[model samples]
Target: MTIISLQHVTKDYGHGRGIFDVSFHVKKGTVYGFLGPNGAGKTTAIRHIMGFSKPQQGIVTVSGLNSWNNASTIQETLGYLPGEVALPEHLTGEQFIQMMMDLRKIKDDTHCKKLMDFFELDASGKVKRMSLGMKRKLAIVTAFMHDPDILVLDEPTSGLDPIMQQRFIDFIKDEKRRGKTILLSSHIFTEVDATCDEISIIKEGHIISSFNKQELLNMTEKVFHLTVENTKDYTQLIQMIESDITFQLISKNEQINELQISCYPSDLSKLIKRIADFPLLSFSEVPFSLEKHFMEFYDRRVGGELPWQ
Candidate 1:
């Protein structure tokens, strides 16, 4: 079931500064990724879903209830972690957790303790003295303490180091397995790929692409990086790709006579045969990457087939 839906949502801030004609849905017990960079309207669309801002042209709903009209109830029940975490500097982390618990009327501290421990957060320190990563962990702990059925996390690991980022990624996976519905918005490609059941790439206030995890996997393309023995082979290789559609030129380094090409699994044998006789310095297949597909969408013109597609 769709737990959240936005139909033809348009929130135009003058000069193309807001989401426009945005529409997507998040099913129950799935992670939906809103992938984009800063100023890509990711935050804008998220704000609308959370009912923090009303859509001027469409409806935003959570569990079939109009988000704007039932804003309080929706926000109260959903665990939300904003991209920029703001906390009271005067309070210790423990004190802030207590305050949140009191405000939400949560009598159970058991879940909160587990979250703090899982994140290795030391809540005795004052917020003012906390490092950026520490502050981020504190925010994560509080957002998840209630163990809400649904969560909306925006750049949830913004200030975390690599270790903490991986921890957050693992945490997301654990939550997914528990059947929690999650909306994860982040520009980091790996986290989104690792956790999301569905992905929507939003760029310049518009959702340019959307696909499920299986679809993305089904469309995966293998990239091969190889260096030829000399310019003769390199020129011939480039010409070969230009003539046929089987091999796709991804990149080239003329000075070193090296180049990268993408080959669909169905055509890998054909590519190998076509270049088997060429004098080569080295050849290797690069692992599949979602970033490649994402950048193609970001850079391609208004109507062009995606490289992976």
Candidate 2:
């Protein structure tokens, strides 16, 4: 089921810099990553979906309802954790949870204690006395306890400790198993790589790429690092190899030359066969890394910008 859709959804400040004609869809029971760098219009797009701000152009729909027209109803079914959380200093953890449930008119507190115990949060502690991580944990528990169908989280795990982060991952997995939809906005690629089924990357307020996680992973090329024992520079090795195989000599020492090469699927056999010529002291085909893939995308975006614009 298509749980959420944004069609040409645009929001901008005075400078005409925000999400420009952005469109995407989120399916039910899947996790989607909304990826971008700072000032890439991620927060603006999120605000429009949450109905905190109205879009100047285009539409955002959740469960077939206009995000702004039926904001309250949409919110009832949405669990949101904002990038920046501000809790009143005077309110205790327990009080805050009660206030949240009151606004939704939910009388049952069944999940409150359970969530607190799960996160090891102190419900009796005042907001002012709690650490940043503790406050974040409290917000996370509060957002999830209501059993919402759609979760919209912005930078959800920024301040969390490693243990809490692992637990959060477990929580998202459990939510997905129960057929909940999640939209996660994150700069942390590793977390997104681990949690998201589909990912859309935005750069300078534009959608650069959108694809399924497994597909992207498969497209990432494996890098082969070779250090030849024989005395040969990168130029000599390039001359010896066939032209179809793409290779780059990264560095060279007195006795060995280091090369970073990529082999296309069709050329994998040819590439392995050609390596027999060089005295291979160290030859390792490194697995593709999500971090490297993310950097490559970012570099392309940065380098492709027009000079005048």
Candidate 3:
């Protein structure tokens, strides 16, 4: 079942800003990754789903209810962590948590205490004196305190330390096991790569690519790094590669006589035969990683052409 969805959603802010024709759905009990850098309309798209903003076109819905029309209901029930958290400074952390519980009319504190203890949050101090990491933990605790079925987290682990980040990642995995639907918007590749069932890369307010994480992992293309023994062999190999269409040169280092080439697995035999003709120092295959795919999109957005293009 589709728990949350945005269809042809557009919130154009002019000057080529805001999301355009964006569409994606988070299925029940699956974690969907919304990948993009800052100012890439990630927050804008998320805001539409949370009913914080109305879209100029298309529809945004949660549990079959229109987001804009059912703003109060959705906002009150959905677990949400904003990209930037702003807490009231005057209240103590304990008091703030209490205030949230009061608003939600939560009588039981079992889950709330578990979240605080798991995050190691010290809510005794005033909110103003708390560090950024502490504040982030507080926000996390509050978001999950009510045990909402659907979670929409925007850059949720921004201020967390490495240890805390890992804990949060683990916690997300646990939630997934418990059959919770989550929509995570983040540029942190590792977190998304580790937790998401499906991922969509958004750039300049457009959904550039969307695919199952497993499909990417099972791609047939393979990358190999070859290091020639000398400049003479390297020069000859470069010529051989340029004259053939079986492989694409990803990168080259003249000083080290190293070349990174990409080709299909079926062509590996041909590559080996061609490389055998050259005097090489070393050769190794580099595994494809999510970071590499993410960088491809990011590089293009920053005015650099894609490696394949």
Predicted structure 3, TM vs. truth: 0.83
- All candidates' TM-scores? 0.84, 0.85, 0.83
Per-residue lDDT of 48-114 in model 2, one digit per residue for the tens? 8898888888999999999999999998899999898798779998899888889878878777667
Of 1 and 2, the candidate ahead on lDDT is 1
Instruction: Give the higher-TM-score candidate: 1 or 3.
Output: 1
- In order, candidate lDDTs are 0.89, 0.81, 0.90
Q: Judging by lDDT against the true structure, name the best candidate.
A: 3
Error of 2 at 244 (Å): 4.8
Ranking by lDDT: 3, 1, 2
Q: Candidate 3: list runs displaced more than 4 Å.
A: 225-261, 265-284, 301-309
Q: What would the per-residue lDDT of candidate 3 be over residues 1-309, giving only the tens digit for each residue?
A: 999999999999999899999999999999999999888999999889988899999999999999999987986668999889799999999999999999888999999999999999999999999999999999999999999899999998899999999999999999999999999999999999889999999889998888788776655478899999999989889988888999898899998899998888778899999889888888899976798889878767533443443
Ranking by TM-score: 2, 1, 3
Cα lDDT of model 2 overall? 0.81
Distance (Å) between predicted and true CA of 246, model 3?
Answer: 5.0
Residue 280, candidate 3: alpha-carbon lDDT? 82
